[model samples]
Target chain A: LQALENIQLDLEAVNIKAGKAFLRLKRKFIQMRRPFLERRDLIIRHIPGFWVKAFLNHPKISILINRRDEDIFRYLTNLQVQDLRHISMGYKMKLYFQTNPYFTNMVIVKEFQRNRSGRLVSHSTPIRWHRGQEPQARRHRNQDTNHSFFIWFSNHSLPEADRIAEIIKNDLWVNPLRYYMMGEGVVRSWASERQTLERPSCFRFWIQ
Target chain B: LQALENIQLDLEAVNIKAGKAFLRLKRKFIQMRRPFLERRDLIIRHIPGFWVKAFLNHPKISILINRRDEDIFRYLTNLQVQDLRHISMGYKMKLYFQTNPYFTNMVIVKEFQRNRSGRLVSHSTPIRWHRGQEPQARRHRNQDTNHSFFIWFSNHSLPEADRIAEIIKNDLWVNPLRYYMMGEGVVRSWASERQTLERPSCFRFWIQ
Candidate 1:
C-alpha cells in the first residue's frame, strides 16, 4: 500500500514538472508572437491606398503588382544617360523623372553587368534611362530611347528611404540569393537633381 | 444650473473621445514594440559566446547601437577574400546576407581610368571573386602595362557579378571613374590579357 502511494506521489511530481515546462514554453511563444503580429499590422497599414485599390480591381481576383512594386526601386532611381545603356534587354524606356532641383533634367540611371569569359561583358556598360514622370511633350522629343518601364513615386526623406529599404530587406522573399542596401550618405548630393546619376563618388559597399 | 451641467457633460464627452484616441495610440505603440522586442531577443539569443566574451571585455559605454548584429555573422561566414579591405576599416559596419546557389565566389579587382582631362585615376572595384578570383594576378605577372591600378574580381554568374558592381556604382568613388564586372564566360573569349591605349583594337564589349 505504501509503495502504491509513493508511485502516485512520483506521478504527481512528474505532472507538475511537465506543467512547469509547458508554461515556460508558452511564455516564450507569446514573446515570439508579439513582434510578428505587430510588424504584420504595420505593413498592412502602410500599403498605399492606390496600390490597395488597384489590387482590388485586378481581374484575377487580387492585386496586380507592376514593376514599381519590384526590388529594383532604390537601385533604379537617380540614373544618368551614361548609366542606362548597360541594361541590355530594355534600353528603350522613354519615361523620365527629373530631379526637383533641376527642372530641365529628365532621366535617371542604374548600372548592371555580367561576366562573359574572363572579361566583363556589359550590355550598356552603365545603363541609363528616363525617369517615368515626365510630361508627354518632353517624352516625345526624347524619342531616341524607349521609356516604357520607368515608374515614379514621391520621393521621401532619408527616414522614408530607410523604411523602403527595410521593406525590401524583409520581402526579399522571391530571390533570397542577393540582398542590397545603400550606404550612409551614398546618395546624391543635396544640390543634385534626383533624376540624375550625380551621386557622390565614394567607396560604398552594396550588401549581396 | 442646467446650462452649467450641460457644459460639464460636454467636457466629459470630450474627455471620453480623448481617452479613446489615447487608447488607440497606446495599442499601436504596443504593437510596434512587440515585434521589435521579440526580434531583438531572437537576435541576442543567436549570438555565439565568443562575441559575447569579446564585447564584454571591451564595452564601449558611449557607443551608439547603429548596425544590426547579423552583420557580424556575414563578416565571419560567406566572406570572400575581397571583404578584407573594408574589414580593415575601423568604422561601424553594415552587413547583408545571402544564400543563393549561384553566389559561388567573391574577388577584389582594381580599375584604372583616365578622365576627360586625361588625368589618370586609380580605384579598387570589388568583383564577385568566383572561379576566376584573380585575373590580375596572372596578367600582372605575364603582361607589362602602365595601367594605374591592376586588380579585378571575376565570377561565373551575372547576378553574382552585380553584387560587386552594386558596391562601386558611384563614378566619383573612383577616377577615370570606371569599373567593370567581368564574367568568366566573357573573359574566356578575350583575344589578349594585355590591352591598352595603343591597342584600342583589342577592346571589345565582350572580352574573352
Candidate 2:
C-alpha cells in the first residue's frame, strides 16, 4: 500500500506538468490565430448586421436577447474578444455600437481577470442609459423571464454570465459566418444541415 | 454587396488556415502528453481495482454496468487509449484482463478509424464466450433495461457507443485517480467535493 501511495504521488506530479504544458500550447495557439482574427474583423465590418445576425442564430445567446435587446443589437457595429496576456490570466470582450437611443457608451467592455488566488474577478463599463431608455432597468428585478441581453454585462455575480462569455469567445467568435448563414436561412440548423448546403466554389470552403 | 462578397471570400481563406493551424497544435499537444500518461499507467497498475473503481464512479459508465458486467470488470487489469497517428484520423482502446471464467481473450481491443470520405469506421475483437456464459446473449435482445456493458463491444451501429468511447478516452483516462477517489468515498461527488478534501502534504497534490 505504501508503494502504491508513492506511485500515486509520482503520477500527480506528472499530471500537473502535463496541465502546465497544455496551457502553454493553448496560449501559443491563441497568439498564432490573432492576425487572422483581426483580418476577419475588417471583412465582417463591411457585411451589414453580421454580428447581430450571428448572435441571433446562436442557441444560447439567441435565447438571451429579448425584443428590446434585438432592437439594440441592430446598432452593433463590431465585436472583439482578446485574451489578456494568456487565457489563464483572463479575457476581455468589447462590443462596439453606433449612436443609439439605448445607451451613450460607444464601446462597452467586459473584462475577466484571475486574481492571485485564482478566483475570477470581472469588471464591466456601466451602460450610461438615456433616461427612460434603460432596457434592463425596465424589466422587473424579480422577474424570471424576458430579461435583456445587456443584463449580462452588469450581472457578473451570476455564473451563467461566465458561461455566456465562454460561448462568445470560443464558439461565436471562432465561426460567426456559420451562425450568420444559419440566420440567413441558408441552413436549417447548425449540426444537421452542415453538409447539406450546396454552394459556389468560393463559398464551399466556409460551409464545412 | 459585391465588395462585401469579396471580403467574405478573403475571410474564409483566413478561417481555413486558422482551422488547420489549430488541428496541428492539438496534435502536438497530444504527443507531448503521451510520456506522462505512460508513467501514470505504470503507477495505477500497482493499485488494485483502480480501473474498476474509476469506472463505477463515472456517471455514464456506471449506469451502463449491470450486475454481471460489474463481475467481469473485477477481472479488468488495465485500460489504455491511444490516438492513431493524429486525433482526427481516429483512436484505439485496449482493455487487458486476467484469465477469467467468462471469456478466453486476455485483451479486448476496440478501434475507430476515419474512412477516406471521413465517415467513422469502428472494429472490435469478438468476445469468445464459453458456451451459455455469454452475458450479453442472455439479455433479451429487445429489452430496454439491465443490458450488460459488454454489449457495447458488439453494437457498433449505436451513436451512443461513440460518445461513450469519447468519455473513456478524454475523461476517464485523463485523471483516473479523481474518479477512483470518488469511488472510495473520499469525495461525495466529483465536482462539488473536489475542494473539500483535506490530505497530508504527500497526498495534497492529487486532491485538487
Candidate 3:
C-alpha cells in the first residue's frame, strides 16, 4: 500500500510539472502573437515635449523611381519622403488620431520631396497634429488650395496601418468628423483610404 | 465556526486569482523587454512552408545617391542598390549561420541588381543555405576572388542593436572561421566587421 501511495505522489508531481509547462507554452504563443512595440529614429510621442522638434531622429526619406504603379505604393514601413514642405511650405493637411490619442505616423507621398540622393529634405510638420481631434488643411497657406493630406493611424501593432489602428481603437476615440474606415486588415484599410485620397498626377502624390 | 470556515475558503479562492494576476503582470513586463518581429515581403520561414509566401505584400526598394558617406549606409532596411551584382557577380563570398543554421536574409548591395526605378533583380540564391549548417561561398561563382558579402540581423525592437545582439548571443554560435564582433549593442559589433570588410567605393557597401 505504501509503494502504491508513493507512486501516486510521483504521478501527481509529474502532472503538476506538465501543467506548468503547458501554461508556459500557451503564454509563449500568446506573447508571440501580441503586437510588438515599434522603435523609429523619430517617435511622435502622445505626450508633447516643450520643443518644436517632437521627433527624436528626424529620418530622411527617399523616392523609388521606375517601378510598377502597384509596387510604388508598397513598402512604406521605413519609407522616406524628402522636402515635402515645397508642396505647400506652410500648408496644413487633414489627419486624425483614433486608436491612439495621437496621430503618430503617416506616409503622405505627395508632400514628401527628395534630392537626387533620394533623401527626404522636408520636415514633418507637428503643428497640424492634435490629440483626439481631426487634422485640417490650412486654407491660408493655400499654395495649391486643393491639397488635402489625409493620414490614418491603425492598431498599435507598431508596423502597418492595422496595428496602429488597433492602438487607436484600444483607446476608443470616435471623432465627430468626416472619416470612414473600409477594409479588414491594417495595410488594406489604410491603403483603401490612400487610394481614395489620391487624385490626378498634378502633384497627386506619386509623380511629385 | 461554520461561517469562519466559509470565509477562509473565499480567501483561498481570492489568493489563487491574485497569484495568476501577478504572474501575468510579470510576464507582461518581460514581454515588453523582448525583441519584436520584422514583417517583410518575404520571410524565409524557420519552419517549412505550407504557404508559398509568408508575408502578405512584397515591398519596393529604392536607391539613394550623393548622400554623406555615413548617411549612405544609414538605412539598410529599405535602402536599394541597383546593378550591385556587377561588384563581384559570379563572385565568392563567405557566410555562416549560428543560432539559425540558415543565414536566411542577405543584403547583397551590388549583386542584387535592380532596374532604373529600383527593384531587386537577382532572387537571393538559396543554394548556399542548409537547415542546420554554416554557409559556404560558391568558388565557381567567385568571378572576383577578393569579394566577400557579410550581413547582420537585429531583433525588431524599433530601435537599438543590443537587443538583436542579445538574441544572437542567446543562442551563441561560435564558429571556427575568422569572425569578430565588437559593440555595446547590435549596430556597432557588426558595423566594425563591415568597416573591415569594406574594400573601396567600387560598389563598396556604403556607396554605389
Candidate numbers, best lDDT first, in rank order = 2, 1, 3
In the order shown, the candidates' Cα RMSDs to the true structure are 24.5, 9.2, 24.8
Ranking by DockQ: 2, 1, 3
Name the regions of candidate 3 deviating beyond 4 angstroms. Answer: A1-123, A127-149, A152-208, B1-111, B120-122, B128-205
By summed lDDT, the worst window of 10 consecutive residues in model 3 chain B runs over B53-62
What DockQ does each listed candidate score?
0.02, 0.08, 0.01
Interface RMSD of each: 28.3, 9.6, 27.1
Report the TM-score of chain B alone for all candidates. 0.23, 0.74, 0.19
Which of the two, 1 or 3, has more TM-score?
A: 3
In the range B84-145, model 3's lDDT, one tens digit per residue, is 22221121121222223333444422222222322223233343344532313433544332
Chain A TM-score for each of the predictions:
0.23, 0.74, 0.19
Residue-wise C-alpha lDDT for candidate 1, range B1-208, written one tens digit per residue: 2332244344334334433433333343334334433443343335433222222222121021112222322332211111112121111111123442222333333433322321223344343433532334444554432121112122222222222332222110111001111122454234124211132211110110
Per lDDT, the best of the predicted structures is 2
Give the alpha carbon lDDT tens digit for every residue of B108-146 in model 2: 998876444334578899999888777546666535334
lDDT of model number 3:
0.25
